[model samples]
Target: MAELVLVTGGSGYVAGWCIAELLNRGYDVRTTVRGPGKEESLTQAVSTVADPAGRLTFAVADLLADDGWDAAVKGVDRVLHVASPLGITAGDPAAMIAAARDGTLRVLRAATAAGVKRVVMTSAANTASPSSYATEGTTDETLWTDPDDPTLIPYRRSKTLAERAAWDFMSGHEGPTELTTVLPGAVFGPILSTGTIGSVGIIGRMISGSMPGVPRIGLEIVDVRDIADIHLRAMTAPAAAGERFLATGEFTWMREMAHFLRDGLGPHGHKVSTRQIPDFAVRLTARFRDPSLREITPSLGRRNRHSTDKASRMLGWHPRPAKQTVLNCAQSLIAHGAV
Candidate 1:
């Protein structure tokens, strides 16, 4: 009998790829959806890459609430908790923190009780980063972002808190089930469906000409496929338990990202902006024109980078090149008519 792995959030961008990779590798898979209607679409998305052939199943589970989790983890051998709070730019910080932190505990409590072999949760690379990106150096899993920093944004703070809470929970846990965490930076790459694009929205906006200029910020772009691969590696690897792996890919400035898109996608990338937006202009816009731009003002001229040495040395994981990942993401958005 094949090992059965439970991937939470079937409809998510990363989770969808996880499901496809799991099925491709001959693992009987089950994924969680918040409600009933998403199952059909989720199956359709995963089917584009690999045939489920009745090896895939679905369970209704929401992280914010406690219902449906116990039944969801039943009979599961391993779990990939890939779900996270979304659209966090303009919401109540308290609610987002609660959803992320409490929701993770909810999954952990249920998975521990069910005696699942291992639970690999998806966290962000930002969780292990310095509060200010002004420092120049490469950081790794040893560093921990301060969740209570007053300057931290809701999204960063939420991810850090959630990961911290999970570690804290496992410390007191005296059970057979183990825990591992994979922290990915700026997930990009091919999309299974356009329903949830996540960070790929910036590429969509750029390709659509909605964004007139690029910011000075840099991103450690990791392919979604590579993210899925690392998650699977972390799930079953004996050495991965109680460890955090940074899956941050090659670092590319936003200006360089624009050029990559423009050069790679000739006709399709015509609208992509190659001009860089000045820091003062971005700050001005954030202050008076659009408050949403405030979040990015801090990242202007970001100097910090994350090292993936831990993941490479431990799990033998390597991510695709930044240019390849960027081009693939842009082309996929164009193909899906998302631009």
Candidate 2:
């Protein structure tokens, strides 16, 4: 009999790929949805990459509530807790933090009680980064971002607090189940469907000419497919238990990303603006014109990057090049008519 793996947030971009990969690897997979309405779209999305073949199933659950979690973890061999609040752009910081932290705990408590072999959770690379991206140095999982730092954005703060809460919970845990976390950078790659693109919307904006100019910000771009691969590796690796692995890719600037799209997509890339937006202009726009740009002002001329040597050495993981990931993301957006 195949081991059954329960994946939370089956409708998510990363979670969808994780489901597809698990099914392809011959695992009997069960996933959670907030309601029945998402079941059809989630199945349709996962079907794009791998067939469920009667091995896939669904459970109704919500992170903010506890009614369905226990039943969701019944007889599960492993768990992948990949759902997090997507309030990175705008939301009440306190509300977002509460939801993310409490949601993680909800899943952990259920999985531990069920005696799942391992629970691999998805965290962000920024949770291990310096408060200021201008700090020049390569960081690893050993470093923990200070959640109280006022400079930290809601997304970073929420992720940091949530992961910290998970570790704190595990420290007191006495169970067979173990916890592992995969911290990915800016995740980008092919989309299974057009329903939810997540960060891949940045690529869509560039391809559709929505962005008039590029910022000086740089990102450690990792592919969505690679993100799913590392999750599976962490689920079964003995050394991965109770360890946090940084899964990041090459650091590339927005201007370079624009160039990659322009050069790689031919007619589709023609509208990509490679022009750099001045730091002052971006700051000014964030201050008055568009408040949504505020989240990016602090990232101008970012100098810090993360080291994935730990993931490579421990899990034998290697992410594809940033250029290829960028081009593939843009092409997918075009094909889906998302642009």
Candidate 3:
């Protein structure tokens, strides 16, 4: 019998790709959805890459509530805890932190009780970043972001806290289940569906001419497919237990990404503008017109870069070029009519 793997939040952008990759690798996969209605969309999206056939199944579970988690993990050998609350617009930071931190514990508790062999959780590269991104240097998994830093955004704080909580939980845990985490940078790649693009939305916005000019922000690009690959590697690798791996790929500025879209996609990338927006203009708009812009304003002149040497050496993981990822992202959005 094939090993059964449980993936939380089956309908997510990254989770959808994870399911496809697992199914492609001949694993019998079961995924958690908030409701039954989400199964169809997840199936449709994953079907684009691999045939789910009899290998794919769905379980109803939610991060916010304790219900259905045990059944969701029942009979599974391994777990991929990919589900977590995320948003760009800062609302109540406390609520996001609670959902991420408490929700992760909920999954860990269930998996430990079920005696699952391993659980690979998805964290963010920002979680390993310094309190200030202005510091120019290469950082590895050894660095931990201070969650209590007041300058930290809600999303960053939530991810950092959640990962920390997971480590803390496993520290005192006397269980058979092992835990590993894969931290990814800005995830961009082919979209299986137009449903929820997540961070890939930045590419869609650029292609749609949503912004008059590009912000001075920079991004460490990682393909969604590569992110999925790292997750699977973490789940099975012998050296991955109780370790965290940074999965960042090539670092590219928003301007470079815009230029790639414009030159690579031709007609499809017609709307992409490489014009750099003045930092002052962005600050002014963020101050009054849009609060979401505030989240990225801090990254205006970002100099920090994350190292993937740990993943490369331990798991033989490698990501594609930033230009290719950006071009592919734009092409996918065009095919889906999302731009």
What TM-score against the true fold does each predicted structure earn? Answer: 0.98, 0.98, 0.98
Provide the overall lDDT of each model, using Cα atoms, as 2-decimal numbers.
Answer: 0.91, 0.92, 0.92
Off by over 4 Å in 1: 87-90
Question: What shift in Å separates residue 49 of candidate 3 from its native position after superposition?
Answer: 0.6
**153-262 per-residue lDDT for model 1 (tens digits):** 88899999999999999999999999999999999998888886877999988888899999899999999999999999999789999999999988899889999988
Cα displacement (angstroms), candidate 2, residue 121, comes to: 0.7
lDDT of 3 by residue, 23-116 (tens): 9999999999888888778888899899999999999988889999999999999999999787422487888999999999999999999999
Q: Supply candidate 1's per-residue lDDT for 335.
A: 84
Each prediction's number of clashing residue pairs? 0, 0, 0
Model 3 compared with the native: what TM-score? Answer: 0.98
